[model samples]
Each structure stands twice: as C-alpha cells, then as structure tokens.
Target: MHTAAAVADFHTYPLISALTHLERLPDQLRVQWADGRVSPFHYQWLRDNCPCPQCVYNVTREQVLEIVDVDEDLVALDAHIEQGLLCVRWHGGHTSRFDPGWLRAHAYDDESRAERLAAKPKSQLWDRAFEWPVFDYAALMEDPAALLQWLLALRDSGLTHVRGVPTEPGSLALIAKRISFIRESNFGVLFNVQSKADADSNAYTAFNLPLHSDLPTRELQPGLQFLHCLVNDADGGESIFVDGFAIANALRDEDPEAFRALCEIAVEFRNKDRHSDYRRLAPIIALDALGEVAEIRMANFLRGPFETSVAQMPLLYRAYRRFIAMTRDERFRLVKRLNPGELWCFDNRRTLHARNAFDPASGARHFQGCYIDRDELLSRILVLQR
Candidate 1:
C-alpha cells in the first residue's frame, strides 16, 4: 500500500509479480520476483531513480538527484522486501523504496529485457495488394476511440486514409491538432499544392514528381504528412505511394550489399531558394539500435551529387538506383486518386509518395498539406491509450 510508483511517472504499472527476495551486493541490489525471474539494479541507478520528494520533484515527477552527487563507492547498508516493496537503506544513511510493479517493469535482466523487446509493437509491412486502413473523419473528430484506432494504424501500417474531411482551406490543421501541433518548415504551416510560375520546389509545379519522402534535406524530416484534397477535376495527378520500409527489407533480402550501402553510406540532400536553404547528410536507409529498418531519407529531386570514395561511388549509385527501381515496382506501389472530401495521412519517413503529371490547362486541382512529427503522434497515442 505504501508505494512511490504513482509519484514517479504517469504510467500505472500494476504489480505483475511480487517482490519475493532482495540480496545486497557490493555495488548493486539483486531482486527476485515471485515468478522466479531475477533482476540486478545498480545502487547508483536506484538512488538516481529515487521517487521520494527529496530525490524527485513531486509536481513533474522528474528526477532531481544526480548520480555524481553520491559517492561512487556507495553501497547498500541493508536491503529487504517489506509490504510488497523493495526497500534499501544506503550506506550514507539515505533510504529508497521501490514499488514492486515499477521495479518489475524496469527490470533489466536478460530474460526481462528480452520479454520487453519482444513485446514492442512491430511494423506491419504492406504491399500494393494491402487494403488501406480507412477512417471516417467525423468519427475521429468526435470520438476518442476512433482517434486512437487511426493513430495505431498510422503507427503500425504507416499509411491511412480519412474520408468526409472538409474540403475548405486549412481544414487539415483541425485534424492534425487531434494529434499535436503542426511542424513548421520553410514551406509555411500549411502549404498549398498547385502549379506556380515561381515554384520553389517540384511539389509546387505540375511535373510528375518521383516517389520520395518530404523534406529529407532537414536534419529531422517531418514524421507524418497530411494532404487533404480540396479539388481534383484535373486529368492525371493520381497519387502513388510505396512503403519504403517494405522495399528496404526486400532489398535487404534480395540484394543485401545494396541495402548495406544505403544504410552505411551518407549522402547530401539539399533544398534552396532565393529565400532559404536547408541541407542534410544522412544514409538513405536508417537502422535502429537493433539493426532493424527505422527510416528512409530519400528525395531524388533534392539530392546533391554523390560524395564518397571513388571505389564506393559506383556501389552507391547501384544501390540508389535499385532503391528507386523498387519504389517503382508495381508489386509494392499503391496508386489512388483522392477526391474532394478525402485525405491521405501517412508516415512521411517510411512512406514515399509521388504524383503523376497533370495538365494545368485541363482543369483545376488543389490540395493543402501539413506535417506533424512522430513524437507528437506517439505522445497522443499514449495519452489516449491511458
């Protein structure tokens, strides 16, 4: 009953396993769970993570104690389990108590680590045959559960479509706010997609834009891209999309060398106009700490010349071309014509998008686009899930 778990963080980690035993080691505390799993927490880690009023702020639930403030050779004077908690008396007369639920949740033993990693959500790879996750904009706007479903689809599938959105200008912001604030860039908060005589980028022109992620030139590309169709009477201009992660994985299987080349080699992507210039150097395919595909940074129109050793230059080109070719492959592409009152929202980092050339003389075509970072999406998802 006496626990500091609620004061530590926003999560409510119910006790999955009771704290059965605790052993005091020289520099760490070893805890055993009722389920027979063992976890070793370093004394410093426990002290630094202390949830008490003195060690952590009550209002923000953020840690205030610095590990360096304690002696490097600090040890636990005594350790025991009492009242469903792991209590420790420090050698310097300080004390710390950990809730069993929180303690088990933060356990770092090999088995526990593996269990947590295995429990993490995985990306659901999709191909052209995949049916899109469609949602009703009105339902999402009015219902919390509907919003959570849409967010989950965006997180796992990386692509989604919403219908019944208002076709008015700037209406994209209303749906975007359901997640968080729009990420601003040189292109303004909401950019109009239409032909312009003084176009700063290819997206602004009527040319057939190749498949690519948005704003790869920035250090951190926008995570989610929303394009709400307001008018589509023009001929051509069908939207095309490809799962960059799926293609990257296929390349990893069919042509590992090319996949490695894209993952290891860094290249420059640049965007410049009379008003501003933005540039970034990063690998086309990014892997997480576990070596899984994490992101894809690619925009052919914005790419600068390849800069690498002469020997690797050829390899880079081969890899880059192969990646582009894969995006073009019909097996992986999804082509759809968005109508007025419909919208496409997807992970900008993992879903490469493009448009077919349209004749300005044919008719009118207009769309409003905006961006929201991945952090905001995940945050909103967690809060809604809670």
Candidate 2:
C-alpha cells in the first residue's frame, strides 16, 4: 500500500475527481465529496437517534450507550488515490480499498450518487408562512435579515414566505436595491385575472393556481422572486408556493438516467402574449456545476418545442418526458397560500411559486412586485471582510 504521503496527490485533480455521491444515502451524508472529503451520514436525518445496537442499546440487551460513552469523531482519516483505488486510512491506522471504478464512474455525476443511496420523497407538508420576523418594505429596504432567515429554512421545509408587508407599489423598486444584479423580465408583474371572459377555467379560472416557477427556459434564470402585494380584496387571491429544489432532489434519487438526461438537455421557453415578448433556452434541471441540484425550471406553458440536432432529439425527448412526469408527481409538490400585506421571497433559482385567479367576485386582486438581481441579493448576504 502507498504511504499516506502518496495519496495527497489526488487533491491535485478537480474535487470532482475525488468525490462521489453514494446513491441514496441520508443525513448530511456525503460519502465522498468532490474534494476527496468524507462525511459520516447513514440516512437523511440530521439528528442521530442512531438505532444501531452499538449506539443505542437493544431493549432486550438493556445497555444504552450514553452521549458521553461514544467517541465523538467516530473514525477520522485522510484518503489517498492509489493504484486507481481511493483508500481510506481509519482512525486506528487500518486501511480499506474502495472500488476505484465505482467512484470514477459516478464522479461529478450526483445522479449516480443519489441512486446508490436510494433516497425518495416522503409526504412533506408546508402550509402557513414561516415564524421568522416579516419586515415591511421600508425595513427590508434597509435590513435583509428576515429574508436570510427564510432562505436558510430551505434546509428543512424547502420553502418559506414573508408575510404582512405594508405594500407600496413603489416599494418594489427600493426592494430591488438590496440585490447584486437584476434579471429584468418582459413582465415584471404582469396580471391576468379571473374574468367571465377567461377561457381555460370553466369558472373564470377563479381558484388559486397550482405551484410552478416563473420561468423555465432562460439559460440564466432569476435567482430570487419578490412580490409586494399592493392590494388584497376582502376575499380570496392568496399566493401559493411549492419547493422545487426538494422535488428535483427526490427525482434525482429515484432515477439517475432521468436525472442525467434532464441535466444534459435544454428546454425552450417562449412567451408570445400580445403584451409580452420573451424567450429562453435552459435545462429543466439545473445544477451548481459542482453536481448538486441548484434549481428546477419547470414551466409547461412557457417551454417551446424542442429544437435540437437530429441526433440529440430522441435523447432530448426522453429527458423531456422525465421532467414532465416528475413535475406532475403530487408527492414532489408542496402547497402554500400567501395573503396580502405579505411579502414572499422565493429562491427564484431554487423554488417554484404560483397563484390562483382571484375572484373579482368579491373584490380586486393586485400585487405590486419587482425584481432584485440575484447577485445583488447574495452580495448583501455574503459581503466579505477581506
């Protein structure tokens, strides 16, 4: 076996060369990250009520390993790539050879990694808004802490909302000041209400619509979406939301090929309404380029027909089908309603949002919203000290 000194060479290649996603593992359970880093995670749960008899006593065995009983760093060691194999040196100095082929085959391909772990979607419920402080347009114009808190919540609920903002139609422009860059859309806040003249809805499209993202085909899509509700009728017209990141993640786990295909092909998006003229080309599935699910672009209506090289068409079609199936899957969709005076910000890059047609039946439905460049938003969050 090569000495540990020899293994350090593996770090020279891109981290993607060293790391791998073990199909279907749970917890912060990255078996091997692109950086040749390894983290302990057996399943998806973050808190470890580990039921292993060694960690937890079998009721019959009656000997619980108390918190103080276990060595915290379970097994710490560095790894080296030797003879095409990535070997792990256990805390005790013992070593194990990991099948190098298995690691290489899936390197930089998290879909393969997800399959190894067998992760799937469970019924996740998110209805009301988040408990964190919801700020007014003026406060948000100054402080973005509330938005940050809601964003971090994605670790669990995969979605969040900011409620009770005193909406001033002009407030959206100030709100845009916080972001690093803006993705100006043709329709910053276009409206299509429930009217007796409406076509699709047998009943004037009155009910709130299902959850979906704003754009699905832009090669670079808006990373954040903020809507400041300017007016709310005495009755309906609440905003609805679903967590797209979680849904895409669940799909990645259930089918690797489908996941891979989605990443490889770009879906066309077009908006040719009389008032709007816009078009985009992007993948239905997006990644951080580091092999993680970063965003999901799923807009059935916005997507234009596939136009690709003949050789790429069949493969592209296969991927298109996969995306459609997953988007329609109810298990992957979580729903929520947003009330007026409520300012909701969704990770335009990661979350999908929608709203139903409000009933003019009782009152009017109006939302005054604007765009904030994602770069601006992130810069506000990550201003560096150095």
Candidate 3:
C-alpha cells in the first residue's frame, strides 16, 4: 500500500495520504489521495510552475522559464507519484518534479481560493473605548523587540502614541528614518503645523479643521503620518481622530447601498498653489481585490467640483452626506490633547484627523510632522518576524 509512511522522508500533505492514484485527462492531471481528496492541475500550469534547478534558479528561487518559451499546446505525456513528488514528463521532452505538499498548498480550486480570501489581514476597528497604543521612544530606538511590537500595533490598529520623545525641531524625521526614509511632499520633508498668517494650507492655521486624510489630491498619497508635539500650551486645539476604516465597515454592514455608492463613485480632489496644481479622482471608500476595506480617501477641504453625471448626483450626494455625517459623529470621534515630548503616528490612508479652533493668543502650539510609506512599516515587521 502506498501510504504517507512510504514517503515519510519527503514532504507530504497533512490530511492526505500518499498519492493513491493518478488519472490523466485530455488537458489536465488529476490525483487522488487516501483521504478521498481530488486535486486537478492543468498541464500548462504544472509545466509553468516546475520546481527544478533548470526551470527555477536555486539561489534566487525565481522562475527562469519564460511563459513565451513554453509550448502553447503542451500536454503531460506521463504523470505519477514518485517518492512523494508528482513527476510529470511533457510531450516536449521535458520532465518536472513537484512536491505534493507544495501542490496542495498552491491549489487553485474554489475551496482554496475562498480560504485564502478569508485569511487576509483585517483591521481591529476601534470606538470611544479604544485605548491608543503607547510606546517608549527610548526603547523603540534601542530595542528591536520594542520596535517590532510598535510596528505591529500600528499595522493592526492604524495608530500609536510615542511618549518621551525629544521636544526638538526636526525630531520626527529621525524617528521616521528608523523604519524607512521619510516621504517628502509639496509641504517639504518636515513641515511645521503652527498658525501662519500667509499659510496656503488650512493645516497651518488655527481654524477648526474637520476630520480628513492628507494629500487626497496626489495619485499615490502618503500612507503614514508622524506628528511630534514640541509646544502645546494652547487652549481648545484638542486633537481629533476617527478611524475611517471602522466607520466605513459599519456603513458597509448597516447601509450597504450607501457604502456601494461611495465605493463606485469617484470624487475629484485638488490642491492649487503658486507652485503646483495637484489633482486626482478616487472613491472615498477604496477596497482591495478581495472586497476588503484597503484605504479611505476623504478630504472636504481639498474636494473639487463634482464631475459625475447629473442624474447620478443625487445618489452620490446622499452617500457622501451619510459618510461625512458618520465621520463627524461624536460616537466615532476620539478627542485628545497632545503635550510636549509626545508624538503620534497614524495611518494617513485609514485614519481621519482633525484639530479644533484654538486661541492662539492663549499660548503657542507647534508641531513638526513627516510622512512614511505604509509598506515600510509592514516590511520591517515581516523581517523582524523572520
């Protein structure tokens, strides 16, 4: 009996016994296991994904066989399980060996596809009771484990607070460089968030700012934002934040039609200045290929004129109003006052941030801010895990 013990020295599927039978179809190969599970593989697919030293470089582990080099009408001349590996000989005088364990892992059947889609990374939505993750700046700089934990928190929760940071100018850039290079925008590498009389952007003023994401006009907006508080002896300028993804997911479950409208309708965002005229059109609620919330892009201040058809205007406005109302609701908003030596790092694409109107005469409020790409944070976490 050809059982799992027959190929115990080689990699084998967990729930599947050694290959009990192989049936070669006209254009595919089917394998049956002792557990009664059947997996099908097309001749072309097996040929394309051959795990051999010749077809795949051993050092780089990359495929050397170009798709164009393969014969379009390729067929498996013979296929059988040998030493727990699926050995296939093509009609083109080529043989490929595939580990059954690898084959089971890479199956493209409906069940496998559904399982993969369901296992995607999901955000931990937060409300008023959500406690912001706080990290020690010194530990993050000196300890790798601390840094990894901080990055993971930022990835899963989309926000964190770092206390005991140096209250110096341009300090935010140093902290951002630990993960990756700082992402510079039209606002420069490190921009100051203080009241300026001649400020072109509303963020540089003491006016009451609404909850919004940054740089929605850019085609690829910055993913992460770091704000370092140097001075905050002001009054009524409390920091406001709302998890856009959380509210978006709620909107999806409660008012699916409204969610659909926001996802389908593209709104224009623009930033006009003496130096540049940046513009782009994107949906407020963006989703990944698997229909999960990937990012949220909404900026009331940067929103340009509506360009959709006149008939679709009502649907778009209704959805837009509903979303904006949810974001502004007190239930979803978190109000905090940042103090000196404290810094905030948050997902620019997932969190909507705001600031209340402050009395500039009461005291000065200054913060230096910078941006970093989200991929850098994710990459660092992966490397640390390995």
Arranged by lDDT, best first: 1, 3, 2
Off by over 4 Å in 3: 1-21, 32-36, 58-60
Tens-digit lDDT track for model 2 on 159-227?
A: 445554566555555555555444566653432233445343222255555555665545566666666
The candidate scoring highest on TM-score is 1
Ranking by TM-score: 1, 3, 2
Q: On a 0 to 100 scale, what is the lDDT of residue 79 in model 2?
A: 48
Give per-model CA RMSD.
Answer: 1.3, 16.2, 4.3
Residue 247 of model 1: what lDDT?
Answer: 99
lDDT of 3 by residue, 32-74 (tens): 7666778788988988898777787766666788868888888
* Poorest lDDT segment (10 consecutive residues) of candidate 1: 1-10
* Candidate 1 stretches greater than 4 Å from native: 1-7
* Shift in Å, residue 328, candidate 2: 4.3
Q: Worst ten-residue run, lDDT, model 2?
A: 6-15
Candidate 1 residue lDDT tens string, 1-386: 43445447777777888988888888888888888988999988888887888898888988888888898887888888777778888876888888888888788999989999999999999999989899999999999999999999999999999999998898999999999999988889999999999999999889999999999999899999999999999899999999999999999999999999999999999999999999999999999999999999999999999999999999999999999999999999999999999999999999999999999889999999999999999999999987
